[model samples]
Target: MTANLNLYSCDLTDISLSIETILQVVRESKGIDILINNAGIGKFALAEDLELDHWNRVLTLNLTIPFLLTKYVLPHMKRQNFGRLIHITSDADHIGFAEGSLYCASKFGLRGFADSVRQELKGTPITVTTIGPGRVDTFFNGKKPGDRPISLNADDVADQVMHVLSQGQRCEIERIYLKSTFE
Candidate 1:
C-alpha cells in the first residue's frame, strides 16, 4: 500500500529545544491518526565501557523521543477524538541482557512510560500501546533480510502494527509482547 510520507531529520532531543520548529513541523502534518514511535539506537557495551554520550543517545532516542512525539501528537489525536501511539520497544524492556545495562535502562523506562500514559488516556479515544519484540533480523544489527533463523521479520512486525490500526473504536489494546523462536 502506498501512503503519503513526511520525513524530518531534526534531533529529537532538540525537539523540545526548538519548540517553534517542532510546532511548525507538526503544523505541516496537520494531524496524525497513528504515530509509530519506532526510532531507537542500541549501544552494545558493558557498563564500564559505555560512554556518557552512548548512554544519553540511547536513552534520548529510545525513551525520550517517544514521550516527546506522543506529547506533540496527543493534542491532535484528542482533537480528532482518536489516535494510536505505538512504541516499538524491545525485549530488553522486559529482561536485561549482558552488556546492555544502558539499553535496558532506556527500555525499562519506556515500559514505565507506557504504563502511566495508558492509564492517563483511559477515558479518551487515544490508545497507548507498547510492543516488545525479541531480536529481529534487521539492518540495525547488520543482519540482512531472511538471513537470520526464526527471528521476527520486518513484515511480521508491520502486520502486528496493522492489526492494532485495524481495531475498532471501542477496542483498546494495551501491550503486545512477541518472542522469537527457532523454526
Candidate 2:
C-alpha cells in the first residue's frame, strides 16, 4: 500500500513564514495527527571561536524552530484529541562536546522543552517524545552515511521512530536514545 504523503520545503528559520506554511498544511490536510521536529544544523566550533551569527543560526534552527512548530501544531493536535509530537534531539543533549557548544545547548533545550510539554499533556491523548541519537550516518556536519563506522545508521534511528509511532494511545514515551554499540 502506498502511504499518503505531502512534502514541503521551506526555510524553517524564517519563523513567520514557516508557521504560516505549517498552518496552511494543517488546514489543507483537514487536521494534523503527528508532528516530527527534526530539522537541525550543527555549527561546531570552540565557544570562543564560534561566531555570534553562527550561534544564533544554530539556536534558531535547532531550538526555536521546533518550539515554534510545536506551538503552532499543538492546537490542532489538542482539537483532534489524538496526536503525537516527536523531537529528534541528539546525544549532545546529555553530554557536551568540546566544539559542540551551540549544538549541545540547542539539543539540551529541545529535550527540556519536550519533557515539560509531556508533563503538561499528561491527562490528554497528546504525547510528546524526544529521540536522542548519537552520531547518525547522515549528511549532518558535511559527513556521508558511510563516513563514520561508529555512527548509528539513519535507518536505525528511523526504526526507533517507527516504534514510537506504533505505540497505542495508552503508551506515552518520554525519551529514546540511540547510540552505536561501539560508542
Candidate 3:
C-alpha cells in the first residue's frame, strides 16, 4: 500500500498498442506485484440477432484484455515470485441467459481462462482469482439500487477483493462467488 500509485490511460483491448507502457513500468519499477483485470463491457443480444462486430467487441474487451494484461505482467511477477491477478467476471459466466448470449460467452471464456492460468502458476507465488458477483448496479447493468432483481454494491465487490488480498502469502483463494441476499 505504501508504493506510489501510477495510472496510465489507454485502451486495454489494444494490448499491442499499450504494451510499451507496461514495459516502461516494469523497466522503471523493476517488477509488478499486483494486477487486477476488472475491465469489462456488456451488451445483451440474442444469439439470432447478435452481430459479428458486437460479438468481437464484447469478447475483446471482456476476455482478450484481461488475458493480455495478465500476459505482460506475468514475467515480472514470476521474476519477483509474488503477484496477484484478479478478474471481475459475472454470474453469467456460470449461467447462460436467452438474450445475453454474447455477454455470457465472454464471461464464460474468462472464467475458463482464469482457471487454467491459476493451474499454470501453481508452483509460483503468483495467484489468479476471479470475483463473480451475481449482478451489480454499475454501468454493466441498468439496474438501480433495490431493483426487482437484487444487485450487489460495487463497494461490496471491492471489499471482497481487499479481503482476498489481505490473506497475504499464506492463502490461495481461487475464486469468490458473491450473491445478493435475495438470491
The CA lDDT of each predicted structure is: 0.82, 0.89, 0.84
lDDT-better candidate, 1 vs 2: 2
TM-score of 1: 0.87
Candidates 2 and 3, the one with greater TM-score: 2
> Which regions in candidate 3 have their CA more than 4 angstroms from the true location?
141-150
| Count of residue pairs whose backbone atoms collide, per candidate | 0, 0, 0
lDDT of 2 by residue, 1-183 (tens): 996788878889888788888877877776788899989999988899989999888889998889888888888889888899999999999899899888999999999999999988999999998999998888999988788978799889889889999999999888999899987
Model 2, poorest ten-residue lDDT window? 23-32
lDDT of candidate 3 over 55-101, digit per residue (tens): 88889889888877788899889888899888989888899988999
Q: How much is 11 displaced in model 3, in angstroms? A: 2.2
Screening candidate 2 with a backbone cut-off below 3 angstroms (N, C-alpha, C), the clashing residue pairs are: none
Clashing pairs in 1: none
- The C-alpha local distance difference test score for the whole of candidate 2 amounts to 0.89
Choose the strongest candidate by lDDT.
Answer: 2
